[model samples]
Target: MRVPTPRLSIPDEPSLALPRSFWKEFARKNWDREPRLFRGLFQAHFPTLEEMFAALVDASERCLRGEIPPMRAVRLYVEHEDGPGGIPYYSMLFPLNRNHLPVREDGNAHAYLERVTRWLGGKRFGVILNRAQCHHWGHWLQMRSFLSGFYETVGVPLAGADSAVFFGNYRYTPFGIHKDDWHIFYFVVEGKKTISLWPFEALSQREEVPKEPGFIHRAGAIHLRDKAEEERLLSQAQLLEGRAGDLMYWPDSYWHRAEPSEGLAVSASLGVAFRPPEFVGAVAPDGWPDRVRHTELPGGRDWRMPATLRTALQQRMGRKSLLALERERTTEWVRLLASGAMEGAAPVLTEAPLSPHEWLLGSPARPLVSFPLPEAQVLVSANGHSRAIPAPPAVRRRLEGLVERLNSGAPQQVEALEEAFFTRLTARAFSRRAFRELLDELVRWRAVRRCEPPASQRR
Candidate 1:
C-alpha cells in the first residue's frame, strides 16, 4: 500500500516553545502523511551538548556500579572491517554482566572504559544505553523536565515514552532500511549524523529491495545490503544531516538509516505514542464501561480497559454492530499504520518491590541506611499511562544529599538519615512510619538501596 510522501518541515529561528497551533496543524494535515519529518523541533530546549555527553558518561558509570541492569538497559556493538557480504557490519550480541556493564575479568570499571576507548579508536564500536533517563543521575533531569513541558504544550494524551542514548563512530548502520512504529524525536548531542530516508512507495517500485515480512510492534531494521540498490533508492531519498543541538522528528514507518559522519557521535532518540481523544470511543462499544471490568488481550497482555466493560460490551453488542465497529476501527488503524502513529508494544506495568535494605529500616536497633539510585524518579500517570516524574522538592533535596553521601563511598547509618530528614523537614511533615514507607518505596523502585557499613566500622 503506497502512501503520499509528506513534506519535511525545517523552521527558521527555531524556538524551544512551539506554538500549540503547530502541533494541531501537524496532526490535522500531516497525521496520515507517510514519512512525516521535521527538523529543529527542539531548538534550545534541552541541556547543552557537553552536558549530554557528561550525562552519558555518568550513566555508564552507574551501570558499571551494578545500578542499572546492563542486559536490559545497555547494548554494545562492534563493527567489523570485512564481512562475507563485503558490506560494513556490526554485531550487537556482545555479552555483558547482569548490570549491563562490559565484562572485564581482570580489570575494574576504569579499565573497562579504557579498553572500550582503545577498541573504538580504529574499529567501529558503539554503545547504546536504553532508558538513559533512569541512569544518568541528575544530569539528565533537564531533558526530562523539557519533555514534560513539551507534553503540556502539545496537549496530546501520551501512552508511553522513553529515551535511548547512542554512542558510536561508524560509517555503517547495523540494520539497513527500516521503519519504526512510534514517533521519534532525535537529538544530536555531539558529532554529526547523516540520515537517508526513502518513502515506501519508492522502495515498492524497485526489485532491489525484496518485500520483507510484516513488522510486529517491535522496532527492527530491515536489512538491505546491495550498494547498487541503495544507489537506486538514494536517487529519490531525502537526506538529513544533524549536528550537536540539532533535533529531528520522523513519524513511524518512515524507512531510514543513519551513520555517523565523524569519528564519534552521541545522540538521543525519544519515542512517543500519542493516543487521540476519540480512540476509546472508536474501539469500545457504547456500554463498554459497564460491560467489562478488566480483560486481557491476546498473549496475556493486560488490556487497559476494564474487564467488565469488555465482557459486557461483548455480550451486549450484536455481531453486526460489532462487525461494523470493527471495520471502522480497522480503517482508522490503517490510517494510523500508514503514518506510523500506532503503538507497537503493549503497555507494561512493573511492580516495584522493597529492597532488603528497606526491609531492615523497620528495625530501630539495626540502623539500616539507604541511598537513592542514580537519576531515579517515581512513575506517575499523566495521560492514563505511567510517566517519570521528578521527586517533590523536599524529597529531591533529601535524595540528592543521600546520593552525595553514597558517592563518597562511605556507609551511612539509617538513624543519622532519619535525624537529617527530621531536621531538614519538620518532624510533622512526615510521620516516622510515613518516612519509612517513602524510603521503602524508593528502594522498591530501584531508586535507592540499603547500605552496609564496612566490617571495620560495624562494631
Candidate 2:
C-alpha cells in the first residue's frame, strides 16, 4: 500500500471570522483579485477590546525592558513633521541607545506612555509588534490560532507567511502610499481604519523621500504632495473601511496606504507571501560536497573527484539511491503544515518533564496533523513539531483515537491512558516505561501541556 502526501486537516470549529457566504465569495471572485470587507466575523474570536489593548501595552513594555528575543522586525512609529516624507512624518518611535538599539526606562506602560507624550509635546505614537507564531504570549497564540482557519480556507502559502500588529493614532499612514510584495489580510481588533487603495498602474511612480538620518526603513513610496498630484491620486483611490471585529482583504498588486478614522487603533495584519506554484516544493541539498558531485572538469582541467565520499548524494537529492529523502521531505512538510509553519521559525519553550505518577496533560488549541503509516506507526504533528510512534495495528488505532481526543482541548488522566496501553500491549513488546517517555516527549514538544496538579498534590 502506498501512503499519499498529507494535507492539513481543518478543525471542525474554526477560530476565525469565516462565514459561509464570505468563504464562497472569496473563493469565487474576491480572493487574490480585489479588496473586500467582511463584517463582524472576527468579533467573537478575539479577546476583549480592553484586554487586547493591555496586551499591546505589555508587549511594548517588554520591548522597552529588553526582554524581546530576536524579533523578525519591530517598527515603532511616532508621526510628526520631522520625517522625510512631504506632509506626513513617520519614523521609528523608540529612542535608541548608544549601540543603536531601542531604549526603555524602568517604568510601567503608563509612565512610559506619559514620558513619550511629554517628550514629543503631546504627539501621537504607534508601535508594531511582529508576531512569532509559537510565542508563548496569549495574544500571539490567539492570533495564530485565529488565522489557522484562514490557511485552511485558502490553501497554505508556499513562499512564506508572517504577521504583524499595527497600533497607532496617525491620521494618515506615516509610511506613505506604497505596495507590498505579499497579499494582506487585516483584522481590525480595535477602532476604525480605512485604506485608500489604487491600482498598480496608478502612475509612472515617483521616488520616495530619503529617510531621516539614523532612522531605518527607507522603503520606496509614491509622492502625493503636489496639489495636482494629490487631487489626481485622491480621486482614484478606492477607500475601504473596517471597524472593530471586521476584516479586510487586499491583493498585493494594489498600491495602498492607511487612512485611520480618528483616535487610537490596533489591528493585526497577516501576510501570505504567495509565490507562483511552479517555484514551490521540497528542494535538493546544496552543501559543498553535494555541489562537487555536479562539478565538471571545466573543459579538460580535470582533477579526480574527492575521495572520502560513499554515494555522494546519500538521502540528499533522493532521486537515485537516496530513496529515504522523499519520505523525509514528506514527513517534514506534514510537520510544518501541522505547526502552521511561517517565515519565522517557531521557538521551543521550557516544560518540566512528566514524572512517574498519574498526571493530567492536555494542550492542543486545534486539530492535530497526523498520518497512519503502513509500518504500524502513527505520525503526529503538533505546534510545529512531530514524532512517529510504533505500535501494533490495534495499538496504532487506539493511539490515533487518543490524539483526536486531545485535539478537543481537554486534559485526560495519564493513569487512565496507561491503563489502556497496558490492556492493549499485555502480551506485546511495548512497556509502560516507553509510554511514559512518549508522553514526556510530547510535553517537551509543546504538543500537549500539563494540567494543574491533582487534588492530592494540592496538600
Candidate 3:
C-alpha cells in the first residue's frame, strides 16, 4: 500500500502533496534522528522527470553559449574507475576561466563540449548544477508551494533553503562515504538510487580517514577509504532505496553516500545548512553607498594616532553606519527566510517579467515573512528577494489581514490591492503608488504569482 497522493483540495499543506499527519510522524521519528524513505509519494510534485533533465540541459546550453556566472558554475563530472577506487574527473565539457577559475566569457565552452561528447558514451557521467534554482522556472514555484507547508510544520530552518540538481549514472559516490552539516531532502525524479548510512559512532579515528586532494563535492567531510572498514560498515548499514518519485530524508549526523543502480539517476537535493548566516558578504564596507561620504585622509594618517584618521574611522563606524550595516545584514537574513531557501547560497531567481495590470496572489509557501522596522516601514522577503515597504500603524494592521487572506491557498485575483490598506481619501498618493510598485515587486519575488500559473506549474 502507498500513502495517498496529496491533492490541493485537502485542507492542510496541499503544496507538497503530503498530509500534515505524515510530517508530524517524520518530525517525531526521522527528522534528525534516522533515515526515512517514502516510496512513490512525490510523483505528483514532480509530474514529469523531463523537468529535471531540462534543467540540466538548459544549464549546459547556457554554458555552451557562455552565459552568467551561475550557469558557468555547472560542471560535467565523469566517473573514473581505472584507479584503486572509483573516482570522479572533470570532463571539462564547459571550460571558462579567469584567474584559473571558471567565469563567464573567459574560455571556449563549446570546444570542450565537442571534444567530450565522443568519449561520454558507455562511461557513466554526472551533471551537477549548483544554484539550480536559477536554471528552471518550475523549481522555485514548486518549492515555494512545498516549503510553505514545510516551514509551517518544520519551522524555519536556520540555514534557510537552496537547491542543487544531481543528474548522473554513476554507480557510486566518487568522494566515498561522507557527512556534512545540513538537513538534506532528496527528490528522486528518475531511475533508482540507494543510500548507505552510518552514524558518527560507527566511524574510526579521524587520522585514519583518507583525504582526496582533488575538489571533492564536500570540502569539510570525512571520506572513508578502507575496504575492510567498508565491508564491516555495510553489514550494519541502513539502506534507503529511492526510486522515481520518491522522497528521501537523512540527517547531517549520519555519514551517508548514494549508490545508484545501473541506469540514469537524477535527484534534486534541497539542503538547509545548519549554520549561522554570513553577514560579511551581505554587508561590506567597500560597497557602502555614495551617501556614506568618502574622503581621502591626510598623509599624516601614517602617524601614531592622527585625528583625521580617527575622524574618518569614526565616520565609517558611527551609529548611523552601524545601523545601516545591521539593516543590510538583517535584510539578507530576512531575504533567505522570505525566499524560503538558502540551501545552495546562490542568488534568488526572479520570475519572468510582468506588466502592471497582471493579476497576482500571495505564495502559499511564503505568504509574507516580514520584519517591521521603525519609521512606518516594513521589510519583507518572498520567494527570494527582499524589499522595504512603507506601513503605518493603520496600514500595518490591514496588511496583516491581507496576509491572512493570502495564506488561504485559494484561487484568487488582485483588485486595487493598494486600497486594501490605503484609503482613497489619503493625501499621500505616492504611498499608494509605492504600494502598487510593491505588488509588482511581489510578482518578481514570486511572493505573489500570476493568478493562472503557467502550464509547467499545473499539478
Candidate 4:
C-alpha cells in the first residue's frame, strides 16, 4: 500500500507551480561546476504582483505608526550613479530610519512613500524590506508553506531561511559585483532584471583584482574599475534576464550583480541556508529528552552554562574542528548534487487559505473570551512529565485589562481591541501572526471563547 502524502496550503488565485524537473536538471549539470544561469524559469507563478505592492504600501504606513519595529522590518537605500567605476552608490545603510527619506517629518509616511515611489519610477534608487513574514500575515503563510514544500521535495535540512521584498527602478543596480553566503531563490513580481555572473575562482586569479579583506561580507566593484579588467571579465560572464513571475536561483559564493530593465521593478527573494546530512548532527542535534528535562530543569539550568562551556571548549580545542567539519560537509553535498543524488522529488500540491490580513478583514469581529474565572499567570505543572510556560508580561496585562473591561458591562469594539490594545502594545507589535496564534492557543485552553457581534452590529 502507498502511503498518502500531506499537502501544502498554497494561495489559490495566484497559484505556484514548482519547476522540480528544471531544478533537478540544474543540480545535475552545474551543482559542482562554475555558476550558471537559467532564464524565464517561472513566468506564471504570481499574477497578483500589483496587489502585493499595494499591500506593502499600507504596511509601510502601519510601520511608521509605531505599530511595528521599523528598523528590524524595513531597509531603505538611496542610490546615485556617482560612485567609483560609475556604479551606483548606496546611502543610509542597515537599520534605516525616517530621516533617510526625503520627508521633513517622520510622521509624514504618505509623503515619504510618494517620494520614494517617484524616485523608483525615475530609475533613481530602491528599498528593501526584511522579515516580511512578521509584517504581512498572508505573505507569511504562503512563504512558510512554500518553504516547507521546497525542503520536503529537496530532502535537505534547512538551517536558516527568510523572505525579503525589494522595490527598485529601471536600470538600477543597488550593489556592484558581490556574493552572498546563502543560496537565493529570486522571484520577480514586476518589471525585469538582468543578472551577470562570474566564477569566484576566475575572478580571484586576475592580477588586477584587489584581494578582499577577511572580514568583508561582500566584495564590491571599487577595486575592479579598470576598463581592461572589466572587459576581460565580461568576455567570460554568463548573462540571464528575468521578467515578472520568473524564478532564478543563485548558489552560495557565486559573484553576480543585477540591474533592472524597462520600468520600476518589484521582487521577492527567499534566502535559504541548507545543512547537508553530515553537518546536520553538528548544527541541529536530536536532544528532545534533554530539551524536555531542561524545560523541567529548575531555575533554567544556569542560563549562562551553555555559552560558558562552548567558549571553554573552543579555546581548548581550537576552531579548526568546526571549520573542517563545515568544509567536509559542503564538499560531500556538492558531490551528491553533481551525481544526481540530490534531485528533489515530485511535490504534492494543495490550495491554501487567503493570508491572515485578508481573512481577518473579511471576517466579522467576535469576542474570544469564554468565561473569565482566574487571574492570569505563568502556569507550571509536573507529574511523570513536567512543563512550564510563561505568558509574556504585556500579553498577561492585556488579558487582565480585557477581563476588567468585560466585567464592567461595557460593549467592546473589535476594531478598538485590535488597534488600541494589540497593535499599540510594543511587544506584540512585531508580529500580528504571533498575536493571532496566541489567541488560538487561548481558545484551545478554554481561556477564551468566540463571541459573535449582536445582530444589529453584524455586517
Residues 1-459, model 3: lDDT tens digits: 000111132333223546677777778888878878887666355624566555655565566566656444576566655643333433434453221222233233232333344456546666677667666666755555555445556665544566677766666665667776566788887778898987765663466444543212232455445556566667878899988778888877677878757766778887765444444334234422211111110011111212332344446555763866555655564455444444332233356655544556553434455555545666755555666767766666555555555554554445545456566436562365666666666665545557774355466
Index of the highest-TM-score prediction:
3
How many residue pairs of model 4 clash at the backbone? 4
Residue-wise lDDT of candidate 2 within 1-459, one digit each (tens)? Answer: 111122223243224535556566676898767898878666454644444445455444455567774342455667776543346566674453322222234233344445555666777776666653333344445555555545556655544456666766666766668777667888787778998987665543344533355111112467666546665787889988888877888887677888756766777777765442211234423331211111211111112222312133233444544445534544554454455545433445466666645455544433455565434666766655677777677767666666655554545677777776567465565667777877777777656667765666665
lDDT tens string, model 4, 125-200?
5667665543444454345444433543453333345567776552544655667655677777777877887766
Question: How accurate locally, in lDDT, is each candidate?
Answer: 0.48, 0.56, 0.55, 0.45
Off by over 4 Å in 2: 1-14, 50-71, 83-86, 93-115, 132-153, 204-220, 223-228, 276-316, 319-332, 341-380, 386-412, 416-446, 449-459
140-236 per-residue lDDT for model 1 (tens digits) = 3334333433444443222335667776665645666776665677777767877787655545544444456643222545555565656676676
- The per-residue C-alpha lDDT of model 4 at residue 86 equals 54
- Extract clashing residue pairs from model 2: 339-384
Q: Report the Cα RMSD per candidate.
A: 15.1, 11.4, 12.7, 14.4
TM of each candidate vs. truth: 0.53, 0.64, 0.66, 0.52
Error of 1 at 186 (Å): 0.9
Judging by TM-score, tell me the better candidate of 1 and 4.
Answer: 1
Runs in model 1 deviating more than 4 A are 1-17, 28-45, 65-70, 97-117, 137-159, 204-220, 274-431, 434-459
